[model samples]
Target: MPPQQALAIARAFLPKRPWGNRYDYYYTRAKLRTDPLYPGVLAALRDTPGPVLDLGCGLGLLAHALHVDGQPRAYYGVDIDASKIERARQIARRTGLKDARFEVVDLGARWPEHTGNVAILDMLQYLPSQVQAGMLAHVSRMLAPGNKLVIRSALGDDSGRGRTSKVTDLMAHFAGWMQEVPKSYPTRESLEGHLANAGLSATFSPLYGNTPFNNWLIVAERRAG
Candidate 1:
C-alpha cells in the first residue's frame, strides 16, 4: 500500500482501541511497514508454519501493521513495558486478532523458553554488547531448524557512512521525545558476529523510511541440534 494510505489505515484502526499509544506511533509504523524490508518480513512471516514472535513489541505497532495487511498465522509480541504490552493486548482485542497475543518479557536477560518463528525488532541496540551477543545465543538455541529470527535496528553511528549514524539518530530520536533510544549497539561487523556466535547463519538487509539511520535488518535461522 502507498505510505500515505497505509498511514491513514493505521491511524484509523488505532483509535478503536482505547489503550493504544496513538501519538507518534502511526508515523513510526507507517514508515516501517512501507519500508522495503517489510516485504521481506511479510514473505518470511507468511511462510512460517506457526506463529510469529515479536520481541520488544512496543505498543504492537508492527504486530498491528502485520495484521492489517494480512498475516497468515498467529503472532506473539513480547516486551518489557507492561503498559505497552497491555496496550498491545487491548489492540489485539479491539481488532479481533485471534491469532495475536501480547505479554511483558525482556528477551535480553533471557527469552522465555518457547519454540516458534520470532521477529526481534530494533531491540538489540539497548543491550550491552556482551548482553546482545548472549541474547542472540539464547534465541538461536531456542530456534528450531526452520524457525527464523528477523531482526531490525538503526545503523549508522557518527559519520552517517555507516560509521556514526546510530549516535546521530539516537540523539535525534530522543531530542524531544520522552524516552531515550537504546544503547550498546554493535557495529555492523559485530552484529553479524553476534548471530554467528549464537550459532545462527545470518544475513542483513537495509530498511527504508528513515535517513542516516543505522536501520537495517538481520534474518537468522537455527540448525537442528
Candidate 2:
C-alpha cells in the first residue's frame, strides 16, 4: 500500500476515545506502509472466491485492505483478543465497510463455522507444534474446489533471518503485543508435509519485502477432480 493510502486506512481506525487513538493510528499506518503481509495476501486472494475467513485477524486490517482495494468479499475476521475484536467491529461500523464482521474466538479450542477462502497470517508460531499441525489439517479440509488457503508465517530455519524473526517475536511477547511467546515454528518440510497429508497442493514464496523477518507466503488449493 502507498503511504497516502495507508494513511487513509489508518484514519478510519481512529478511536473516539482520546487515550489510545494515537497508538492505533500510528501502528496501523506503520503496519500498512511497511509490512508486505497485506499486499501479498491481497494478491493471493484476488482470484479466489468469497467469503474469506481470516483466522487471527488483528484489528481487521485485512478487512480494511480488502475494502480499500475494492474486493467486495464478505470478510469474517476472528481473533482471540476481545478488545481487538471490539475495536475492529467499531472500525468497520464507523467506516461503513460492507460485508465485514469481527468476532473473538480461541482458535486452539474451536474454529467458527466457515466455508470459503481462509487466511492465517503471522500467527501459526504461537501455537504448539501439534496444535499447528492440527489447525493446518482442519483449515486444509475446509477448502472446497476453487477456494484457497493463504498463510504467511516465519518458517523455521538455521539462518540469521530466522533467528531475527525469533528474537522479534520474543520482543513482541515481552511488550505485551502477543499473549504468548512463540511456542514453535514450522519448517518448510513440515508445513508442506502437513498440507500434502491434508490433500492440498501448496506453493511457497518469500514475503519479506522490506522487513527483516523470515516470512514466507504459502498458498494452497485442492486438486481438481
User: How well is each residue in 1-225 modelled by candidate 1, as lDDT tens digits?
Assistant: 556546644664456558855664565555555566555576666665666777787767666667656665677888887877786787567667777788888666567665777787767777778888877787776676677888877653554545555655467567844243666766778888888777788777776554545577777887445
> Least accurate stretch of 10 residues (summed lDDT) in model 1?
156-165
The whole-model C-alpha lDDT of candidate 1 against the native structure comes to 0.68
Candidate 2 structure quality by residue, lDDT tens digits, 201-224: 999999999888899999999866
Considering only N, C-alpha and C atoms within 3 Å, which residue pairs clash in candidate 2? none
Q: State every prediction's TM-score relative to the real structure.
A: 0.80, 0.96
TM-score of 2: 0.96
The true-versus-predicted C-alpha distance at residue 8 of model 1, in Å, is: 6.8
| Model 2 spans with C-alpha error above 4 angstroms | 17-20
Best by TM-score: 2
RMSD of each: 3.4, 1.3
